[model samples]
Target: MGDASVVEKIYDLVVIGAGWYGLGSAKAYIQLHPNEKILVLEAENSCGGTWSKDRLYPGLKSNNLWGSYEFPDFPMEEKVYGVSEGQHIPAATLHRYLTDFAKNFGIFERTLFQTKVDSVEATANDEWALNVTSNTSTIQRIQTKKLIVATGLTSQPNMPSYPGEESFVPPFFHAKEFCNRADTVQTCKKATVVGAGKSAFDVAYAFATEGDAQVDLIIRPTGQGPVWICPPYVTPLKRKMEELLSTRALTFMSPCPWQGEDGFSMAHSFLHRTGVGRFIVNNFWNQISSEVVETHGYNDDPEVFKLKPWNSAMWTGSGVGIHNYQTNFFDLVKEGKIRVHLADIVKLDQNTIHLNNGEAFETEVLICATGWKKTSEGLKFKNFSSGLSYTTSDIKRLSKEADKKVHEMFPILKDQPVLRGPVKAEEPLRNYRFIVPSGAVFKRNIAYAGMVSTVCTSIFSTVQGLWISAFLDGKLQRAPKTEDEVTKEIMLHTQFEKWRYPCGYGASLPDFAFDSIPYVDLLVNDLGLKNHRKSSPILELLEAYKPKDYLGLGEEWVEAYGNQ
Candidate 1:
């Protein structure tokens, strides 16, 4: 822990979490206000939130390729990082790149690692009082004029409780802790993994290939089925998957309500509004889905066919994953090395797992690849003036109104996929532009980044960092000025997420895949900056947008609007 006097001092800005969003936000703010005192608090020992040293396990690779995963200002050079453009970046390489990004931008000097924020309250003096504790057991109070919560969605793991897990457990844990228990991959004879997400598949694959273990992958019959896993390349042209999703022309094919601002209002309307255009858009998505399914040979065996996604690629948000493994992941399953079970765990008893479908499995290790908790779970947020925590009412009424508006604006969203099982109801977040809470728009002292889930997180985090900095600096010309306007805006976006990504985390935060570019366009426009980064209209539509296109955005904003 630092000195007691240091904790007593107040700062111009304080950022929580040292991940991609936190580092990006701090760098952007400091660029605009060079002399301001800024501090970043991270719970982990090092940077790179999800890719931190504590989380990397064997066989873990990024869904993103080399070019699409890097920050715009600091390119991950092929020579420097030893990674090529088409290859999926390894976890170690990404961690090294993020650490270097922090050091290069001076964010490392401003950050305090292993400091966990216990609670945060709004002070009467219009500041934020953060009560934090370090790993050394030292507690202190730190205050800041502005706060940005960039903890993101992956901080806390969601470990479900089973009936007899306490007594029957033999090395049972969540996948996030795989780094610590990595020896289990080589030692375990048999392993059982729960859930069907990316993490589950990665864990099962590691056990099946790295060791002599027989892996059992359990996909709950009541939960969302297997996710759509696409190859690295797609389409008849064999374009990179991430590149295809990032291209404006391909993104425009998705029924996004905000794509009209791309200077193709007529084309957007014709594609999403007319019957013939809808057929073309639907056919495009269907073809992409069919190609992926056929490439994987899911139909070769009945058990392998069960791995096919329950929802269409168009309706599935971030649930769609990339097949970035070195070898064919399905080959092991076909060879009886990995078995898939479509049943829920009934109980665990002494290295045995009883299923709801009258089946019992004996395994030496049990790894739960279950998802994460809500981003706002750990910290307590309180409103300064009211002396009460912020809460929302009439969400149902607002959702109805917003749903009607979305259907009227984009009729294509009305045709939603039929979801299996009961989805746990999630309260829509009330943050304006998914950054500042609707009530805090006037305060402008608190904001959030990386709370929104998207495939193009590099671009989103960079643009969101600029938006939050400008809004905190009071330079945004298009921010909502009135409370009612901000509330309505937040409500509409929240409801649009519900309709756009019903199968993913849309109900809690902004979640999308291909629609990330248009979402960034909205933020760019709000900052009074040009959304188009390319020179020609043809290139702008066809060429994929990478971090390079958004390079030096903070400098551009300051140059255009002056760093007042």
Candidate 2:
């Protein structure tokens, strides 16, 4: 606002996106460092990243419980499923909550709203050069000592291709556009939704409830892992049953679950997903029964999944899992409120959508909820985020593996050359917590400012865990405790697999995932009630975790020296 032509002062740290993760880093940083030069750049005038955006149809809400989505902090320590009868926070409400988080913490003061980061470049020095445009404003460059790429995956919708729909032109847009209400083209008598993912369901449900129109839903064979709106209370009980059934099934070599003859064990699933596979048992039950879309996968898998495009995993199997229809989404399809078309498109025309079976359906208005494609159309600006040039080799080096597809990983500088006078040796050890390589150590530097150089960042751990690690190094005192350093130490530990970050495999189940309990004997740990939380509800009968005492819930470092 001052001196339009003047370049803003360089910041100690430059944070992109003001969403949940973004706010986590900023607020945590401020907790320990009061006067750091930090600047938050948001494309929209507001702070909620995904929640603040995406209107799709109305009566919109989240499937995740309100308690599950609460920020990890004091004050709002109490949680509930306020809307979904004690289930999840709605999309609109989430947006407002995040907005409130920023206002209360005064984070907006550090923000340059209506600004979009178009590109970034690595300066001759290690600092980052960002080219950002404020709403309707000229492009401006801001230099900062550090850059936080907190823009989440949802920021980009994975749109798929459809036929002859481009010319329809009534009012076609992504789910993001529908959130605003005005984005609807013609809510014509027959509205056809092209995808069956969660967004597609939301789109279909919205049109039916808000537009009062019968909706036709088109689902790709693999896109249907539909979990419906079950009472959240039942989740725990149902989960236990499945686990016991899976354990017994796997032990006695009983028939595989999910009706698979492939004998696809959960072990194999974990192997493919970096040992961090989603709960397949849950996946089957949820998708076949639930309506929320869990994964927004690209048709081009290995290409998008691998770090170097070469380190891809094999596909197991996928198809529609909509067998439970007494009252499932398919029931809506059966009731004619929502029509179902099972054929894949063989052709596309201005007025007709042809499926592979050569069947053509004429429609009044088409809601190409056909989904968005993953393209480099407008988001190529990430190429400009730093000074050093990025290559496949660069990504591999940073990933500490042949692959560079980091989902829940914190980006860091791994395998960078360590000089030893004239000759460079494989970095002997990672020096600091933020700087640790997988299962290794190195020259230590706590000033997180220059310390985002770990081999692999944990993307799956508590978001607070990732947030605090980087925040401490970047803005806070830049100090790590013994345990913090040790755990991060193991991450950088030189022992290959031991040095590697934990994969999202079979471990996320109740017991395995929550194994690292923090002293709360009877408390809920993100996953809710501990013991029964492990296996499944069927196996565990009725249950409760009313922990009389919380154990190991607080680490020595986290309790005594965290973002207090």
Candidate 3:
């Protein structure tokens, strides 16, 4: 809402995307640099990236529980939000909380809604120039000394096309549009959902129970099969799944490169290095997988059995989901209300879809639950001097070397899973510690947040926010001094992710679940702060890490390194 003359004024910092990570970064920066002029640019009219108001549909809930999803500094109180412990937070509740967060932290006034950053380039004066467009078709240029991108990975929907689809049109759209097209579920007598991810399950359930319409779920034979859906409270102990996963002891079972940083070096070596320890670790994962299958009763019915996960749980990253519905979702399939098909759509005709398995289905509605694009395409980044993209040909050469080294260290990942199709090899994202680009670390003028996909997003975002503020303010004590060291560290970390989470999106992003705590520890140590938040070593090993555990981490960083 400002005039063209406003572009001449340079800002100290500019942040893109007003979602969870974006708001967190802005709040952290403002807390550290109180008087700096910082602005936040958001394309949506509102905040809450994935949980924005326009995106909320009926019966939608987060995979994470209430206690594990809030920021470290702000707790989602029961009296304020009406969400209690152990219950999955509704999409609306999360949106409200984020709206309140922005206002409380003074970020709402700094954010520019409906403004999209088209591209960004480095300037000769070691600053960033951004080309932005508003919803009213107003184009403008803005400059800032530092920039933080938090658009995340789910900004763009990945919709696939089938042959002859133009002829048959009965409300065909992606699942992300379900909120706007809610009438399709109420009016259609029958509907078909494509893909087998968490979104697919949610759509099928809504169609079957909410609308009482027959639903067909199609999972392509060539792609990864259904994901592992665990009950809210799993195992014989009946401990909350999110809490169990947050414990440091549970992460030791998973092979992670940085778990040893938590003062468990001996345990890490035994589990990943010794053959006997390997046997024990494998059995632990097998038992967990078996428990999920039995808990869901997948083997009782043939149609329900089709929902079993195709890969081992050890190889899974974010592919694992939580079953937070009020009723048993499998019961609907067992009753023959929601059908499951393991086939690919060959073509689409008028009110009909042909499958590669010599089958055809006629439906009045089609909803695609396919995943999102791997990276954000809205912003284009370029080098100031070279005028080239951040990604270069050297990535391929360095990645190959990193792969060999990772295989040597973790031999368990040597045997890779085989997908059916000719999968396109994507170049791994080259960012040191999954934040700054390796080539631009010395500049310290640009950073990324929420780029990695993890179940513990709140914890990761808060720690990352503090870390970014420290690095940009020249308060970090253990940062790499040379570009060569930064590049080497980035390549090795990316390669480890490739092997650690083979079935998920690890090839292009840092995707993890239980290992998030260790990842945060790495960042905390770099800021010259204590990684352990608990009072005793025993408690640190057994207790679950939550948002409250990290309360005052920003102040902790300030106490240790603020003066520098």
> What TM value does model 3 have?
0.96
Looking at candidate 1, the ten consecutive residues that score lowest on lDDT are 384-393
Task: Write model 3 residue lDDT over 1-564, tens digit each, in one string.
Answer: 222224334789999988989998999999999899998888888889998888888789999998899998889999999999778999999999999999999898788888889889888888999988876435488889999989988789999999999998788999889989888778987999999899999999989988999999999887878988999888788888878778999888887777777778898888877899888888988888889889998887799999988877787887688998989899999998999999999999999999999999899999999989967777787654311133566666777898888877677778777755566677766688898876568888888898898888899889999899888877787889876777677878888998888778787788887788989989999988889999998889888999889999999878877776
Model 1 ranges with Cα > 4 A deviation: 1-8, 136-139, 384-393
Better of 1 and 2 by TM-score: 1
Against the hidden reference, what TM-scores do the models get? 0.96, 0.58, 0.96
Q: Clashes in model 3: which pairs?
A: none
**Model 2, 1-564: lDDT tens per residue?**
211334356877777777666776676556545677877777766777656654424655654433334454422233422343244455666777777777776676677677788776656555678877776446487887766655543455555556665665444555666656433433565566776445666667666655667776765543322322222332433442112222322221211111122233454335324323334433443342332222222223332121011101111111111121112443354457776665466655776667775667766555555433222134344323211123656534643541232222212212222221232122222322222322211111112111221101111122333333444354223334454444333323222221121111111111121111211211122212232223564432223221111222223234544545
Give the poorly placed runs of model 2, Cα more than 4 Å off: 1-7, 53-57, 74-85, 136-139, 181-186, 222-231, 235-328, 368-462, 465-564
Model 1 agreement with the true structure over 1-564: per-residue lDDT tens digits = 222224434899999999999988988888888898888899898899999998999988899998899899999999999999688999998899999999998898888888889888988877899988886435488889999999988988999899998898689999999999999999998999998898999999999988869999999877778988889898779998888888999887877767766767888888888999888989988988889889998877887887988877887787678998878889888888999999989899998999998999899999999989866477776654321123445666777888899998788899888878887786766687888876578888988898888889899889999999999878896877677777677778888888888778777677878888888888899888889999999899999999899997887888889745
Candidate 2, 152: how far from true, in Å?
0.7
